[model samples]
Target: MDLRPARAHEAGLLTELALESKGYWDYDEAFLAACRDELTLIPADVERRRTTVAEEDGRVLGFTTLDGIPPEGALGMMFIAPGAIGRGIGRRLFEHTAAKARRLGFARLTIDADPNAEPFYRAMGAVRIGETPSGSIPGRVLPLMEYVLTPR
Candidate 1:
């Protein structure tokens, strides 16, 4: 798959992909609707947050966003298309995000991951630091993880 920066006009497409990816975990409509805005990829964020897309043959397979200031930032978003999950796309996107974080001088990347994705992040070398409240669901919490960029 090819990894490249996301384009401005592709915001809607990316947002749909994120929602679909999230729904892959079997979340109900109400739950997904509640998370829509929080999962959206705004055009401005494309450049500001360093959004990246993974594609192949001109088809978007996955995407990730590296957010916040250097030396510490959030893996703001990482989603693989429902059809593309389990084919190593998520892993590739995670590695690409981490590499970009390191290049931007980030010493660590924080992740507020869905319970379903916690194991994946852990497999990618992130450790669960605690829990964080969901931006959309008031009573929901997610695994808060940290990935160190500096070499061991």
Candidate 2:
């Protein structure tokens, strides 16, 4: 697999991939529907953020986005295709993202992670600093994780 910048034309494809990945946690239809907007990747998002895709054989296995200015940033999104789950793709994506963040001079990268993905983030060396209200679900709270980027 290779990591590359996502093209604007891939917005829809990436959006579907994100929803499928999120659904891997077994969220019901209503919840998924509610999340659609927040998860949607517009062409501008693809062009503006450090959005990248992990592709093999021209197929995207996963994608992630890094957003904000140096010294502080957010892992805006991290999604793995449902079929690619548990294949260590998520690990690769996170490591690559962390490295990118460090290279970009970020001191810390925050993540608003799905509950089911919290353990994965923990494994990636992030600590849950707190919780934030979900942007999608009104009553839901998501784990807020932070990875302190060290100088390479």
Candidate 3:
């Protein structure tokens, strides 16, 4: 798979990917709805953040959005096409995002992850800091974690 920064043409596909990702949290309809803004905001938000796309055979397979440089970091979004999961696309995206974070002088990378995705982040070296209520759920919550990297 080839990974590169996202371009204007991929905006619609990225929106689709974001919706598909929201579907994974079946128990939380509110969470999905709350994410509506992100789906619409990403393309425009690229002006201030790092957005990368993963492609294989000229097809978009996944994407990752970095909110800011590491240390004071955040992952605005990370989604892989349903058909492309478990093939290392997400890891490559994380590595790419992390490398950029390091270069930008971030010392820690954080993600407010979907509960189902906590394991993957753990494998990537993110230690759970705490859990916070889901944006859409009145009482449901998910893990917040961070991966600490050496200073650049």
Candidate 4:
């Protein structure tokens, strides 16, 4: 797969990929509904943040977004198409995001990860720091993790 910056016009396609990837967990309709707004990605977002897509055979298989700068950078979004899961697509996108963050001078990267995605982040070298209230689900807590980029 090739990792490249997301194009302005591919926002809608990326958004669809995000929703479909999320749905892969088989959450109830109400849960998905609550998370809709947070999952939606628009053209403006593409222009505002550092976003990249994993493409192969002219098809986007996954994507990730990075927000903020040094000492405060965050993995804002990451999703892999349902059909592309378990083929190392997510890992490639994540490593790319981390490398980009380092190049941008970030000392670390933070992640507010979904419960189902905690393991992936952990395997990517993120350590649990705490929990934060979910932006979409009432009374839900999300894992807060950090991947330190600077050497000790």
Candidate 5:
């Protein structure tokens, strides 16, 4: 697979991939509908953040985005194509994102992770910090996590 910076024009495709990845968890339509706006990615977001895409044979398989600057950077988005799950693609994207955050002088990276994705983030060394109210759903909470970057 070829991992590289995401191009602006690819935002739509990446957004679709994210939704598909999220749908893999089998949430109901109402839940998915509520998340639509939050999952949407626009070109400006791509231009403003550090976004990376993993592709193979010209097909995008996964992607991740890092936003803000240290001492508090954020993992803004991360998604693996439904077919690409369980193949370590998410791990590769995460490691790349963490290293990039470190290089950018971030002391730590924060993630408001999906409950389904908490295990993956935990395995990647993110510690559960707390839960935050979800912006889209009333009374719903999302897991907040942090990954500390060792000084280089």
Candidate 6:
């Protein structure tokens, strides 16, 4: 798999990838529509933030985005094509985001992990800092996990 900086022309593909992971995010049809809107903006946002894509055979398979370097670099929107799940893409993305954070002098990478994704983040060395109650999402809560890379 080749990991490269995501270019601006890839938003449509990334949107598809995001929708492909609906099962993992636990987003219903209504929720997914909203999420899709956000995902579609990723390519444009990449021009302003750090966004990387993982591809193989010239096809986009996954992506990871970083926001606001640490003391706080958010590990936001790490998604792998649904067909590519369990193939180590998520791990690679996590490592990429972590390394980027370190390079930027961040001491922590945090995530508000969707419930189904909590275990994956835990396995990636993020500790459950706390739980964020359903803020905007009705009937759904998320765990706020923090991967401490250095003493705060």
Q: Please write out the lDDT profile of model 5 over residues 44-116, one tens digit for every residue.
A: 8886888899999999999999999678889999999999899999999999988888888999988999999
lDDT of residue 66 for candidate 5: 94
List the candidates ranked by lDDT, beginning with the highest: 2, 1, 5, 4, 3, 6
How many pairs of residues collide in each model?
A: 0, 0, 1, 0, 0, 0
Worst window of 10 by summed lDDT in candidate 1: 143-152
Off by over 4 Å in 5: none
Top model number, lDDT: 2
Q: Each candidate's TM vs. the true structure?
A: 0.97, 0.98, 0.87, 0.96, 0.96, 0.87
* Candidate 1 structure quality by residue, lDDT tens digits, 19-95: 99999999999999999999998888899989999999999999999999988899999999998899998998998
Q: lDDT of all the models against the reference? A: 0.93, 0.94, 0.80, 0.91, 0.91, 0.79
Tens digits of per-residue lDDT for model 3, 64-116:
88887445888778988877888999999998888888888788877888888
Which pairs of residues have clashing backbones in candidate 2? none
TM-score of 1: 0.97
Clashing pairs in 4: none
Better of 3 and 4 by TM-score: 4
10 Cα displacement, candidate 3 (Å): 2.3
TM-score of model 6 (CA atoms): 0.87
If candidate 2 were superposed on the true structure by all CA atoms, what would the RMSD be? 0.7
- The C-alpha RMSD of each candidate to the native structure, in angstroms, is 1.0, 0.7, 2.2, 1.4, 1.0, 2.6
- The alpha-carbon lDDT assigned to residue 78 of candidate 6 equals 83
Residue 146 alpha-carbon offset, candidate 1, angstroms: 0.5
> For candidate 2, lDDT tens digit of each residue in 1-152?
89888999999999999999999999999999999999999999996888989999999999999999999999999999999999899999888988998998999999999999999999999999999999999889999999999987
Over the stretch 1-152, how does candidate 6's per-residue lDDT look in tens digits? 99898888887777677778755556678787655655564456875668889999999999888888457778877888888999999999888878878878888887878788889999999999887764446666689999987532
